[model samples]
Target: MNAPFGARGTALVLPQPYLLFLGDTTEPGFAKTAFGLRDWAGDKCVGEFALPGATVTTHLARMTPAQAYAEGARGLVIGVANPGGMIPPAWRKSLVEALEAGLDIVSGMHVRLGDIPELAEAAALLGRRLIDIRVPPAEIPVANGRKRSGKRLLTVGTDCALGKKYTALGLARAFRQRGVDADFRATGQTGIMIAGGGMPMDAVVSDFEAGAAELLSPDAAPDHWDVIEGQGSLMHPAFAAVSLGLLHGSQPDVFVVCHEPGRTEMLGTAGYKLTSVEEVVELTILLGRRTNKAIRCGGFSYNTSALGAEAAIALMARESDRLGLPVADPMRGGAAFDALVASCLA
Candidate 1:
């Protein structure tokens, strides 16, 4: 398939074309990279390559590494963000096969691919590059709680994989289409890969995580909108600190809460019940007020991929009316997002 034009009607271009490897799992952790790529790098994605006997997710189009290479793909991206951030042994063979075929590798896992001797040797022999996206930045200073000029909008979630980055990107796109000077401030690997620059918050030392956000959105023109991508969740058992740090560092003028419609629990944790969207919004606003007392809840981005089109639209409407705020699925195209952007920036 050909690359599609972005919102500005400009053709999308990548430094190097690649295919994403999602293996057999389409769970939230494993499938997020592919979804992010599709949303931001649509033209650059040749197709997804899955493991043998793996079931492809309904939304992603599947193709073999060879097929992708035939169509100008030069690398394979390890797209899963599994628990523990380690590559599964079952996926080793497929990765090796791709290396043997001269495809470079890119991964965001905590386990660096170049650290594996065999994989390193294969890449060296094939003269291919192995990019590990989770590597910590060289020098991240502490945050001083300094103020910035532009209007900042942050997307915080009730849990990981709840589409914070997607929501941020969607709003940035919407703002741009409306002739607003909006920039997406990515804070994770997948988001960095798409935006071409961002600190990987999880890899940074705890003290510097918030500092990274402070540096990312340094004073821009007052007309600019810095749509900062959030990481983790305030209520998540595993990564709450990181989430709080980002919230405090961004000090957004407005924040949006993102949630999945059918989710009942925090991912990767047992017995942790999911909080209602209203509760999550209130908690985020309360926390954000420590940095900016005037911080407000702009809207919500509800993930309704599991539902039919009609059902999703109906659900969005009901939530919007009940919460008295705009609601939308970032992946589903609609004018609701336009309203959300306006409300947040106004």
Candidate 2:
């Protein structure tokens, strides 16, 4: 989830029913995170705990897994201060205490791969795997709306801060200009909207309005249509995989992925780095199809330079097309994106 945007604030009681705990309760972004909780839960959640300064012992003692879960914690999004945060001498005992309480644990960015074993015993006892949020950050609730009549949906992503949202918004603007009824819905933190800039939540307020419209009319232009802008592959969990799952549920008609040339070239093929463009692409398509999901075009997130963006988008298109799939046409922007969505419906 996003930290505070404009100003530094403490926790705000979120209206939403679900809660995701990031770092210690005192982190800079705690309040903003609480705001996200309220947004997602729609003002149903009691609120979240930041747990700063509170030792694992005191923290777990108060909440007690049984109490927390019984109070309606469907899932627990846990982010350690760090990997070592789990095994530290003081925390070890408290960790054990919380685990014994039987709370299902889901890991956020703070819980890396190497830290898996740190909580293994607790995880097994809890009867749930410590979900890897980094793979896609958050567990996207299946998109709940009228299914897209189309078949294609473009998905865009970049290594980290490569401007994925702007590219997605640009595509949305392109399609809207073409009269293709597009709404840029962001699926992750940047899109969840809290504060300053980057994927504003105001962008997706249309969903709320659409919900109101559906309740009122049941059938006007499906409220809004076109596009769903999303965050990049960093920050949260299984970014691509989770996004694809969301697409499956929403049934977007096309796909466009954003790629950064310099990053995609070097990191795209590497296995160890989540930055691998190729790995992300292959894994995304494979999992999407395997799960019977949607994701036709895998577009690239390019820099402002037309030449670089065009080249990367072209290469991705060629490679994806060679493999018989949809890829963004960097040079054609609006036409290419519109065509992909059109093709999905056809």
Whole-model lDDT, candidate 2?
0.42
For each candidate in the order shown, give its overall lDDT on alpha carbons. Answer: 0.79, 0.42
Tens-digit lDDT track of model 1 for 1-346: 1111123222112235778888767575567777778768777778888876655452556777778788888878877778888887888888888887767888878899988877888888888788776775566678888777878999988789878988998888888888888888778888866774566777778888778667667777888888889998899999988888888889899999999998998999987988888898889888888877789999989888899999999999989999999998878967777678778877
User: Backbone collision count in every prediction?
Assistant: 0, 59
* TM-score of each model, paired residue for residue: 0.78, 0.38
Error of 1 at 104 (Å): 4.6
**Could you give the C-alpha RMSD of every candidate to the true structure, in order shown?**
5.5, 13.8
Candidate 2 residue lDDT tens string, 1-346: 2222223121111112233443343443333434333443333342343344733221222354456556765444443344343424444444444456544444334434236565676667555454433333112222355533432244546544455555555555555565665544444443333211222212223324223212211121543444455444421243444344343443443455556555423234434343555555665566445323555443444453445655655665665565454445433554445554444344
Number of the predicted model whose TM-score against the real structure is largest: 1
Weakest ten-residue segment in model 1 by summed lDDT: 1-10
What is candidate 2's CA lDDT for residue 174?
58
